[model samples]
Target: MTAILSVNRAQKKFSGLVAVNDVSFDVREGELLGLIGPNGSGKTTMLNLISGALRPSAGEIRLKDERISGHSAHHIARQGVARTFQLVRILPSMTAEENVMAGAVFARNRLWGADAHGLARKLLARVGLDGRADMPVASMTYIDQKRIELARALASDPRVLLLDEWLAGLNPTELQIGIALIDDLRREGRTIIMVEHVMDAIRTLCDRCVVMNTGTKIAEGDVAKVLSEPEVVRAYLGDDDDA
Candidate 1:
């Protein structure tokens, strides 16, 4: 697989407190990479940094040999990197299809605007929202909101997709649908980095896992191996000695 994005020795600090320390990793083309850590372990912070919402104190972030560090969020977004927030980004008054059309902005160059709406319909359909396209977000549940968010992200036609806590709050049925949509995205060859706590979802979707602790990387490898590591277990299970 080809390396599409790389973070080398990345560091981010605020008020002399380090949030992400010397993190290094590479996302290969068409690979689903999982980021896992205990609460307050810098998972979301790292995601924010890479997505250009925050600036790193130091380090190099490359998108296929092009330096992307310090670039604005919108600039990074235009470079084929799209992220869906933990909270839904849809507007309550807008129809689900309209929400997705918001994402299809600037995509007309790809299809002359003739097929873009068709593409949005297909994305909505894929996420099981075909019948709910005209429904207002205020009338939808959390699960539907998330599914629409995923469709919006895909409208970018991205090379790398970063999903923040995509499975955080949902019922069993909702979880199943969420997982299925993510699986479908992967099957379509989108390289995804998912920071999620649902171990079952991670195991079912990610090709490998990167575990972090106290703002630093502790272990990384195939899902089962990393999940079984002593340090990995300690990070998630807690170290009682210090407490």
Candidate 2:
């Protein structure tokens, strides 16, 4: 598969602190890549850079050979990139369908009125929201809210989907459903980069893994191989027994 997205030596600084440091990786077309790490590992920062939520202090990000690192978030979204936040972001005042319609309205190829509404309903069902399209998002459960967000992202018809902790709050049953939903997307040949803490999902969904620690890339390869590395173990478990 061709490398659809590339982060080449990307770096981000916040004054004296560095959030992402010289990180580099390639996400191939139709690949589901896992970005895993402990808290404060610069994983989210890297996503922000790719999604254009934050500009990199150095280096570049390219989407299918086009430089996109310095573009605005909206620009990136319009250029076939869409994402779900670590915290589910839905319009509380809007119905599920309306929330999803917003994505279609401002997407890569903008849809409007009936077209957007039609697409929103289809996406809502795709993410298992089914008949709840008219329900207010604020009234939905956490998992349902997440589904809305996922549906919204999909509504954009993104070439690359970025999921930030999409499975973080699920119970065992919900976790299985969440994993299944993502797996379905993978089967559809969607290229995705997911940042998640659940090892089960990582093991089941990712074609490969990238491990980050304290703002730097530490490992990049097979899920089992990367997780077994001493540094990765230490990064998660710490050097001391308490970790």
Candidate 3:
């Protein structure tokens, strides 16, 4: 598989602290890559950097060979990169359909009025929010809110998708649904980068994994192998007694 996204020794600094330190990785086209580590291990920071929420302090990030490290979030988004936040972002005052329409309007070429609304309905249905399209987002459950966020991101028709702890608050049934939705996206040839603590989901979904700690990559390769590494087990899973 060809590299669709590449981070060449990327770094992000806040004041004197380095949140991501010389991290490098390649996300291949049409593959699902998992990022896993304990809290504050720089997983979310990496995602944010790739999605253009934060510019790297040093080094370069490329989307299919086009430098995007220093671009603004909206510019990167417009270039076919989209992401979902760990905390779902939604317009509580608007109906689910309207929120999705907001995204659809800017999807490809600024769809307007009826065209945007029509696409919004289709996207809502795609994410299983069909009948609930007219319902206010404030009235939706946490999982449904997540679905709306996903639909909004999908409306953009992104080339690279970034998910930050998207499965954190899901219940069993919802978890299954979410897993299936991810599977469907993979089948559709979407390139996805997911930051998750759900080991089961990671094992089942990711073609490969990258493990980080203290803002640096610790281990990477096949999911099971990386998870089984002694250092990974110690740093991420803790001692046997603790587990």
Candidate 4:
């Protein structure tokens, strides 16, 4: 399959500190590409670059062959790229349905009024929050808030969905449900880049994996193979100490 998104030698610097350094990868159309590494490995930074939340200091990001590196976040969202934050972000003052409607209203195709409301309800149900559409986001549990965020991301009908540790804080049961929901999205042919620490989810969901360390890519290949690489092991576990 052709690449739906490409990060060409992307780099991001904050003052003199390099947050993401010459990281390059491609997310194929309909493939769930895993971006995994230790803390401070620049995974979220990479997502920010792709989502237009941060402009790259060097290199470029392309979506369907269109350069989007310097574009604004809203512009990127309006261009069919939607994302869920590592920490769930929602409109605290908005009802579940209204929050989701915000996505549709600001999206690429832009829905309105009843159309947005209808889509919001459908997405709320899709994320398993059926009758709670009238409730404020603040009243929901952490996992439920996650569901709302995912539903909101989907409301835009995004071509590429960026999931930044969407499964981070779930318990065992919730993890299963979260994995299944993501699997359903994958089966529906959604192109996704997932930044995760959960190895089980990485093995279960990703078609390929990209491993990063200290802001640079260390490995890229099949999940099992990449996980077994010596450098990848060192990046995560720190040099066996005896060796």
Candidate 5:
């Protein structure tokens, strides 16, 4: 498989402290890559950098063979990248259909005209929100809100989707549903890079996992192996000697 995204020596700093330090990895086309670590481990910062929400402090990021440093979020979206946040950022006043249609407007660029509404309807149904299209966002449950969030990201028809903690609040049943959705997404050939805290989802959904600590990569391998490593335990549990 070819690499769809590459982060080489990526770094980020704030208040004279390093949040991400020389982290590098490649996400292959049509594969699910998980970025996992303890809290404040710079996972979401990396996602923001890749999706153009934040600029890297140093090093390079590439989409395919073309370098994509310093591009705006809109520019990055137009380049076929999309992302969902840990928190659902929806317009509380908008109905479910309208929220998804808002996304369709950008993704299809009005090519669909009245058909954009139709496309939004289809996406809602695809994500199991068919009956709730006319409902206001404020009326939906957490899981529904998340599905809508995903629908909005999919509205862009992105080639690469960066998901940050997309499963944090889901119940076991909902997690299973998300796993099915991720599988379907891969079947559709979408390359996914996710920063996930949900270990079950990460173990079941990813092809390979990347582990991080203090903004740097510490391990990359099969889920079980990485989870069992001393480095991973120390990162999550902490070493008293360092304290």
Candidate 6:
């Protein structure tokens, strides 16, 4: 399968610290790829570079063979990329639908007025937030806020969706709902690259997985095999030295 997105020797630095170092990977079209790592292992930084929130200090990132590393985040979004944050990021003062409408307004071809509102309503309902559309996002529960943010991301009609720990705070029922939603998106052929710590979801949902450690990719392969690798285990659980 052809890759929908490629990170070719990508690197990022902040001051003298290297956040992402020579990380390279390919995300095949219609595949759900999991990026897993211990804390501060550069998974989120890699996502930032791909989403144009940060520029690579070296190398390139491409979406459909077009280099997108240096482009503005909005420019990349218009190129059919959309993402949700690790923390919920909705317009707290706005109604849930209004926040989703903001995303629709910037969608490729861009919807407006009644059309945007209609799409927002549908997206909200898709994420199980139908009746809460008019509620201020700040007044919603944490899981509801996450759903609103997800609805907003979908309002952009993205071909590639980057999810950053989107399932972090969910209860079991909500987790199942989130997993089902992702399964539906995969069936629709959306390419997804997710930074996730939820091992169950990664094991069940990822077509393949990449493990990162100290700014480098330590392992990449089938989920069970990758997770069982000694290096990956050490990265996550520490060696005898830490004991």
Top candidate (lDDT): 2
lDDT of 4: 0.95
lDDT of 3 at 19: 87
Over 51-93, each residue of candidate 2 has an lDDT whose tens digit, in order, gives 9999999999999979999999999999999999999999999
Query: Candidate 2: deviation at residue 36, Å?
Result: 0.6
In model 2, where is the ten-residue run with the lowest total lDDT?
234-243
In candidate 4, stretches whose alpha carbon ends up further than 4 angstroms from where it belongs are none
Q: Model 1 residue 74 lDDT?
A: 81
After superposition, which runs of candidate 2 have C-alpha atoms over 4 Å from their true positions? 240-243
lDDT for model 6, on a 0 to 1 scale?
Answer: 0.91
What is residue 168's positional error in candidate 3, in angstroms?
A: 1.0
Q: Considering TM-score, which of the candidate structures 1 and 4 is the better prediction for this target?
A: 4
> What do the candidate models score in CA lDDT, each in turn?
0.87, 0.96, 0.90, 0.95, 0.87, 0.91
Better of 5 and 6 by lDDT: 6
Clashing pairs in 5: 21-215
The TM-score between candidate 6 and the true structure equals 0.96
- Give per-model CA RMSD: 1.7, 1.0, 1.7, 1.1, 1.8, 1.1
| Preferred candidate (lDDT higher): 4 or 6 | 4
Candidate with the larger lDDT of 2 and 3? 2
Itemize residue pairs with steric clashes in candidate 1: none
Off by over 4 Å in 3: 239-243
lDDT for model 2, please.
0.96
In angstroms, the error of model 2 at 123 is 0.8
Candidate 6 regions with alpha-carbon error over 4 angstroms? none
Clashes by residue pair, model 3? none
lDDT of 3 by residue, 67-180 (tens): 998998988888888899999999999999988887777664567888888888998899888888899999899999999999988888888999998898999999999999
Candidate 6: tens digits of C-alpha lDDT, residues 4-92: 99999999999999989999999999999999999999999998998899989999999997999999999999998999999888898
TM-score of 4: 0.98
TM-score of 1: 0.94
TM-score of each: 0.94, 0.98, 0.95, 0.98, 0.93, 0.96
